[model samples]
Target: MMLRGALVPGMIALPALAAAFWAYAGEHAALSALAGAATVFVILVVGLLGITAVVLGPAATSMAGAGVVYLGQLILIVTVVLVLRGVDWLDGRAFALSAIAQTLLMQVGQVVGYVRARHEIHPGSLDRGAAS
Candidate 1:
């Protein structure tokens, strides 16, 4: 039940993300607003996944979830860069570096958020399951 609830946001966001990406790609000139919206949606998905992994059982899923999240982020970055480059909106070199930087930042943020949530929920002991 808890795991299902935790996954709800990511599940919902996935479709919205697809729609946003489609819309962006369909446009002759993608709007910065659209890019920002897509980025926000991705962030939300990452946050939800990170939180879900943390809350359910950090030790059990943290590494795996983080790896998956990181990979997804890399894919997203590549997709975004390809789209932007195809549209001539961003230079390839700059976009590539930006993508790498963004992934690192996101990973750090996820770790911090997970640690905070873990402590908040279980004060001292870290052995308790998230369902507790």
Candidate 2:
């Protein structure tokens, strides 16, 4: 559980760092696109976390923490997107497609990670414990 908790932040940090790098490089257009995409990603992650929290109750600590991080990221992304849109750097279609694609990719990543983590934590415990 501790290891999983540690890894959750690391998982989020990758995309956050990438977005920050793009923003820092003065690639305003690219940064805006990335920010828009990140917003969608964060929304999807938060939705997933909410579902997990409902199902798992108090055991959903990691998911809840991840959701909070995603929320913060979402706010940053939305602010960047709005700023870019106001400045005329982001086109409608490009912005929309970027957000859609990022959401899909983030969902896939989350599902895969969840499955992999479950397997790691459970291993053969279910079968072995059942036999005992």
RMSD of each: 9.2, 8.1
Would you list the C-alpha lDDT of every candidate in the order shown?
Answer: 0.49, 0.57
lDDT of 1 by residue, 18-102 (tens): 3554465533222433454345446645655664666467687777876776676657756665666666553334334333443
Residues 1-132 of candidate 2: C-alpha lDDT, one tens digit per residue: 323432354356446644654565545545555656656655555555555555566664766665676676567656756766676655544455556556555656665576556643577885685599
- Leading candidate by TM-score: 2
Clashes counted in candidate 1 amount to 0
Segments in model 2 whose C-alpha atoms lie over 4 Å from true places: 1-28, 57-87, 119-132
Off by over 4 Å in 1: 1-74, 120-132
TM-scores for all candidates: the values are 0.40, 0.44
- Cα lDDT of candidate 2 equals 0.57
